[model samples]
Target: MKKAIGKAFLAITGWKGEGAPPEHGRYVLIAAPHTSNWDFPFTLAFAWAYGVEMRWMGKHTLFEGPKGWFFRAVGGVPVIRHERRSMVQQMVDLFTEHDRLALVVPAEGTRSLVPHWKSGFYHIARGANVPVVLGYLDYSRKTGGFGGLLEPTGDMRADMDRVRAFYADKVGKFPEKFGPIRLKEELEADEIAAAKLAS
Candidate 1:
């Protein structure tokens, strides 16, 4: 049902899916270069086309009433904005509880351009001892799908360097709206290192 729905949607929208299904049973899927509202549906459709079940965090309010069932069926996990548990921990817990799960995390955290990518996806994958899979949407070619899988090597800068390379050619719906593929954590580390060297 989902595969058919995804194929039909893509065919109607004229978007082509590139890349293959991930081989890992459990991993953190990084939804990157998110620059438009349409990314949500396209991302879901791309996942469905590949028969990948992706769970993502949605607003707690979005899960209210009858619409809640639909959202949940589509792998939307309601997250309370003020919850005490950090989202990373919440996601890690979910991973620990499930044997085979693909937690979809929009590392950009928003459609608008930001200074850096959020590091929660990296932290969650590390905490759960799972690999991080790069999921991309190249609007330039109207293509979307899995690009590659990367294990969190605990070396932030080196790991992110590899991530940077994978997305170097991927374009978003709004190219100007795509920010640098970097983590603030890494930037801070670089600052700290420079400070130490100057001293």
Candidate 2:
């Protein structure tokens, strides 16, 4: 019934999905090029259409009020942004607790253009021992859905290279508001490479 509603919603909005959802029962599902508020409902719509009971992390404050249960009912997991590394650990622990979890992480962290993506998704996938799946929104084509599956090799650059390739052609609703698909951790990868050359 919910899947039917989701599919109808997408059809009504004239937004269609591209590929099938990932087969992994437990993994980090990243929604990329997230530059607009509309991404939330559309992402949810796709999840329903694909039969993925996807859970997303939202600001903890959102879960504090009377509507908290509503949010949780729709698969929202409250997160305190300032917790940083601890938040990653908590998400990893959640994966341990649930036998089948599809956590949708918005890598951009906000609607505006950002310099780099938060690395928490990468860390969570690695720590949870689950593959990372790319969920994309290409407003240019009026299409969006899961793209590629990446198994972390602990080599940040190599793993991210696969991520980069998948999103290269994905365009956001606000194209100017979308920055490069990069993680701040890649800078550390750069430093490691530089050090090896110097030594």
Candidate 3:
């Protein structure tokens, strides 16, 4: 039923799916170039089409109200951003407790432009000893799907380079709102170097 619904939705929307989800029992799935709200529904449809059940974290407020049941039923996990607790640690613990868990995270953290991507996905995958699955939505081709699994080796720059390469050709709904895929620390360093050169 879900697979049929997913296929129908994609067909009606004129979108195509590519690649496959990770075959591993446990992994962190990170989606990128999330520059529009439509990315969520499109991603959900792709997940259903592929028959991959994934749990995704969202703002705690999204889990409230009458519609909360719908969100929870569809594998939505509420995350309290204001809480001091380490989200990466919490995710790692969840991975530890569950025999098979696929936690999906939007590395961009928001549907707006930012200097760099949040590293929570990398930290969570590393701490949990799981691979990172590269999930993407390429608006240019009107296609959405997973790319491949990346094993985090604690080399942030090197790992991010591969991530950047994968998303290089992919276009977001709002391309202007999608910044280069780099770590915050690396972006800051580049800014500092540029400032020094100007001075």
Better of 1 and 2 by TM-score: 1
Can you tell me which runs of candidate 2 are displaced by over 4 Å? 80-85, 188-199
Clashes of 2: 0
Q: Against the hidden reference, what TM-scores do the models get?
A: 0.94, 0.91, 0.91
lDDT digits (tens) for residues 63-151 of candidate 2: 99799999998999987777755889889988999999999999988889988889999999999999999998889888989887889
Best by lDDT: 1
**Top-down lDDT ranking:** 1, 2, 3
Ranked by TM-score, the better of candidates 1 and 3 is 1
**Of the pair 1 and 3, which is ahead by lDDT?**
1
The stretch of ten residues in a row with the least summed lDDT in candidate 3 is 81-90
Better of 1 and 2 by lDDT: 1
lDDT of 3 by residue, 1-199 (tens): 8889888999999999998877788999987779999998888889889988888987889989998999997889887777787778778888989888889899989998987899999999999999999999999989999897899998888898899889899899999999978988778878999999999
Q: Which structure among the candidates has the greatest TM-score?
A: 1
- Cα error of candidate 2 at position 183, Å: 1.0
The positional error of residue 33 in candidate 2, measured at the CA in angstroms, is 0.7
TM-score of predicted model 1?
0.94
RMSD of 2: 2.4
